[model samples]
Target: MKNIGQRLLEERRRLGYSQQYLARAGGVSAHEQRQYEQGEDLPRADYLAQLAAHGVDVVYVVTGKRSTVINISRDQAQTLMDNRVVGQEVTLDGPPEEDLYFKLSDPSGPPPDQS
Candidate 1:
């Protein structure tokens, strides 16, 4: 299995960010970022959260597990369909009947009475 540092490096490279850029974004020094990529050190929780905000897959970087939730805006989804990036058409309205990678809970309890 790959180490967390290796995963962090991969994610940084995937985003085309330099060590300095990533460090600045994560509110750390470039040296620290280098150390993280080299597996010499681990980032703090706040730094990890910063990385997530910058679109880094923090969960994958730490635990090597990809998140099941796939967040895409309606416009982005429409664009994917227009470009044939997705083969199947999807409706954003209502809960999906089938199981998906992530499940949405009914947060409001139950619907109001029709009567």
Candidate 2:
């Protein structure tokens, strides 16, 4: 398992962020950011929250496990963020929009087959 600092550094590199930039966004000094990335110091909860707002997956940084964060939006990638997916389970919330016209109007894809 990677250390928190290693994971933090990995995330930072993945986003192409400099320590100075991330530190400013997290309300910390660049030196502090180095310490956090070097495993010399642990970041505060508030600092972590700030990093999250700046696109850092703090959950993954701390726990080495990514959180169930889904972008529930009308515009995104080709994959549809269906409401039926809750956490790790696929749930049936309702009849699932049976309107063929609605499906045709949707850009995600065609409606699921009833058969």
Candidate 3:
């Protein structure tokens, strides 16, 4: 398993954010930021909260795994954020939409009659 610092550094680089930028955004001294990324010291809870506020996934920070709950098509995601998605019940809190739409592609392709 990767260390916390390594994971944090990976996420930072993945977002194309510089250490200095993250430090400022996360409200920590540059030296502290370097240390955190170097495994010298762990950031306090408040600092972690700051990073999360800036869109850094706290689960990824601690467990190095993606645990985001939201999942939607890029277009749908934007639409939901824009307060749309009315009448899109499947996309809401319910069974997966795939269950409902799966038959459309095979409307006349169901199994042969068992007469």
Where is the poorest 10-residue window by lDDT in model 2?
95-104
Q: Where in model 2 is the C-alpha error above 4 Å?
A: 74-115
Model 3 — TM-score against the truth? 0.60
Leading candidate by lDDT = 1
Candidate 3 C-alpha lDDT tens digits along 1-115? 8888888898788788899988998899999999999999997888888887566766788987775444355556445545755555433344444221111234568788899
> Each prediction's Cα lDDT score?
0.82, 0.78, 0.73
Clashing pairs in 2: none
Error of model 2, residue 72, in angstroms: 3.6
Q: Which residue window of length 10 is worst by lDDT in model 1?
A: 96-105
Off by over 4 Å in 3: 71-115
- In order of listing, the candidates' clash counts read 0, 0, 0
Compute each candidate's TM-score over C-alphas: 0.64, 0.64, 0.60
| Model 1: lDDT of residue 79 | 67
Residues 38-114, candidate 2, lDDT per residue (tens digit)? 99999999999999878898889999987666433233211343443445533333344421111124467778999
Residue runs of model 1 more than 4 Å from their true location after superposition: 74-115
